[model samples]
Target: MENARSGNAGKHKTRASIVEVAARLLHEQGTAAVTTRAVAQAAGMQAPTIYRFFEDKDALLDAVAQHVFTTYVAGKRLVEDSDDPVADLRAGWDAHIGFGLANAALFGLLTDPNRGTRSPAAAAGLEILRARVRRIAAIGRLRVTERRAVELIHAAGTGAVLTLLSSPPQDRDLGLADAMYEAVMRQILTDAPALPADGTTAATVAFRAIAPKLPMLTDAERTLLSEWLNRAGDDPASFDASHRRG
Candidate 1:
């Protein structure tokens, strides 16, 4: 049992060491410098030993991306959530832009179309964004559906990072990310003081946030009401008439 425990600990340490070496190479020399041979040499291990922990270069890159992503997320999670969901969302956007710029190589690897769908780290980040959007909806501030808001924020943040990264540091427009966030927010959120004219939309969004917890409604009733609420989001007049008839 002692020998078995020792072997497992050694394997875990070696795996972490390889990932750390690859991450450093990626940061200093970009993706091309993160080859299996270079990483093995940097980590003081044989090339085949890298394969024992990772199936290929792609797998190693995935591990490096996850490490960077997880580290960034841990730092972000340290900041407590604010009472103002909009402010929280803005903070999240800034953090994402900062992460991408600071870890350009890792960001590029994580955003690669070939690996993004398979990246657990990327999905975890999106889940955090979703939670933020849900909070906005609960506060009756969101104008669009939660899914739409999430997509818009994600796309805007990704586009802002890639745009900034493409330019020389001195030439980059630092305000571009803030502008993008504002543009997306305009489309996804109700204006403060949320006019009575837009009350139906705001009410629908707020109720949709708690639709599942409606104790007076049966499962089937809740599902049916949800469909109508979704439709109401598109055509308030028609939904009002249908509700009157019911």
Candidate 2:
């Protein structure tokens, strides 16, 4: 048992070492420089040894992405949440942009169409975003359902990063991200009015936040109510007409 435990630990260390070496190479030299031979040489291991841990270059890149993402998320977790949810959300947006800009290669690998959502790190980041959006809804400030708000914010943030990354650093518009955030905020949040102009929408948003917790309803019933609430939030008049018909 002791020998087997030692072997497992050694294997884990070797895998981590290879991933760390590949991550550094990807950061400094971009994805094209992360060949198995290059990573093995950097880690002081044979090329075949890398294959023992990773099946192919794609797998190695995935490991590198996971390593970079874990490091980034660890830093984010150390930062305490702000009392003001909106402020917290803004901080998250800035952090995300900084992470993407600083780790361009890893960001590119994580955002690749084939590998993007499949990354556990990417899913963790989305969960963080969702939590932030939920905080806003809990405060009765969100004008849309929590899910919709999360989607809008995620789409805007991803688009902003890709847009800025596409431009040369010297020519990139630093303000674009802030502007996009503001645009999404306008679309998804209520103003400082005592009551939103669209009361049904605000009610829908608020109710959708707690819809899942209603013990009176089954899962399917809650789902149907959530769908109705979403439709109401989007178009109260249409939702009302549909209900009247029903």
Candidate 3:
């Protein structure tokens, strides 16, 4: 029993080590740079050993998503004490941006269309994200629909961060960037006709507006949503359409 436990521990450690090294390579050099042969070399393991842990490139990329969501986005929380819906929204916004900036590579993989919907790891990661959105909605502060509010708030904030990351040197200013973020957020919270606050708490108001329309998704639909959410990192069009049409 002791030997068996020791062997399992060693296998776990090796798998973890591969994931760490692969994540670094993907983040630093992008997914294309993280070939099985290259990752094996970097991990100081043979190619076949790497294959033992992951079925294929997609599987490894899914593991990369796992690392990003688990290590970074998973622990994110906002507005722990604030009852103000606006304040809670802002806190959630900031946390979302911070996570993207901190984990650009994993963010990239999560967004890649080619990554597809094969890996269980990616599916699990999306479930974690969905729970976080639910929590943010439960904060009882915002007047917009809970899921839509969560989606819009995140799209605006993280969209801005993506812009900054992709910006040219001459166009980047952190202070001005933050100001722009604040302005966009205010408009999103107050200006949208679809998400008006009519004498109710922001969260409740928002939830009510969107509750009837929230997609009655099958399990496959949920998986598709995960893929779409990640893809929205590059283009918000599909995600926007889904929310509006749903």
Candidate 4:
């Protein structure tokens, strides 16, 4: 048992070290520097050893991206939410923008549709955004459905980073992210929870946040209610049919 445990620990250590080296290479010299040979040499291991933990260069790159994003998510999850959900949401946005700008190569890898869409780390990041948007909806401040609010914030953040990155570092418009955030907020938020006066949109969003927790409803009933609520929450007042993402 002791020998087996030692072997397992050693394997875990080797994999972690390889991933660490690859992540450093990616950050310092971009994706081309993260090849299996480069990583193995940097990690002081044979290239074939990388195959024991990862199938190929793509898998190696995936692990590197995963490790980098997982570290960011760990720290992000530790931030305590304040009494003000909007303030918390803006904090998250700023952190996301800073992370993207700092880890340009990793951000590029994780935003590539073919890889980003398939990454668990990216999905976890999106879940964090969903929770932030859900809080605003629960407070009745959101004018759009939770899904729409999340989508708008995500799209804007990505665009903000890409636009900033396109410019020379010395010439980048740092305030564009703030401007984009305000634009999205204008579209998705109200002055406050106006309920019956602001009408069904905010009410539907607030209710949608708690729909699954209605203990009196059966599972099937809750599912059906959620479907209806989703339709209503994304109704004409909340969603414009013409602006859907491609």
TM-score per prediction, in order, is 0.92, 0.88, 0.63, 0.91
Summing lDDT over every window of 10 consecutive residues in candidate 3, give the lowest-scoring window: 191-200
- Name the lDDT value of residue 141 in candidate 3: 37
TM-score quality measure for candidate 3: 0.63
lDDT of 2 by residue, 25-89 (tens): 99899999999999999999899999999999999998888888977877877888889988999
lDDT agreement of model 3 with the native: 0.61
* Tens-digit lDDT track of model 4 for 1-246: 999999999999999999999999999999999888899899998999999999989988988899999999989899989999999999999999999999999999998998899988899999999999988888889888888889999999999998898888899889999999999999999998856766777887888887777799998899877776776676743333422421
Q: Count the backbone clashes (under 3 Å) in each candidate.
A: 0, 0, 9, 0
After superposing candidate 1 on the true structure, give the runs of residues whose Cα lies further than 4 Å from its correct spot: 193-196, 214-217, 234-238
Ranking by lDDT: 4, 1, 2, 3
Between candidates 1 and 3, the one scoring higher on lDDT is 1
* Better structure of 1 and 2 per TM-score: 1
Order candidates by TM-score, high to low: 1, 4, 2, 3
Query: Which candidate number would show the highest lDDT if scored against the true structure?
Result: 4
Q: For residues 1-246, what per-residue lDDT tens digits would candidate 3 score against the true structure? A: 999999999999999998889988987887788899999999998999999999998788788777666565345432153545445445655666666666666666655556625545445544544444444444433334445544554556656777766866467665654785676556435433223234334534434334445679677766675555444433445655666786
lDDT of 1 at 14: 96
What is the clash count of model 4? Answer: 0
Of 2 and 3, the candidate ahead on TM-score is: 2
Q: Output the TM-score of candidate 2.
A: 0.88
lDDT measured at residue 34 in model 1 versus the true structure, 0 to 100? 94
> Could you tell me the lDDT of residue 206 within candidate 2?
72
Q: CA RMSD for every model?
A: 1.9, 2.5, 9.6, 4.9
Tens-digit lDDT track for model 1 on 1-246? 999999999999999999999999999999999999999999998999999999999889889988888887777768899999889998899889998999888888888888777887788888888988888988888887788889999999999999999999999998999899889989999876245477587778777887887789988898899889887777777888898998
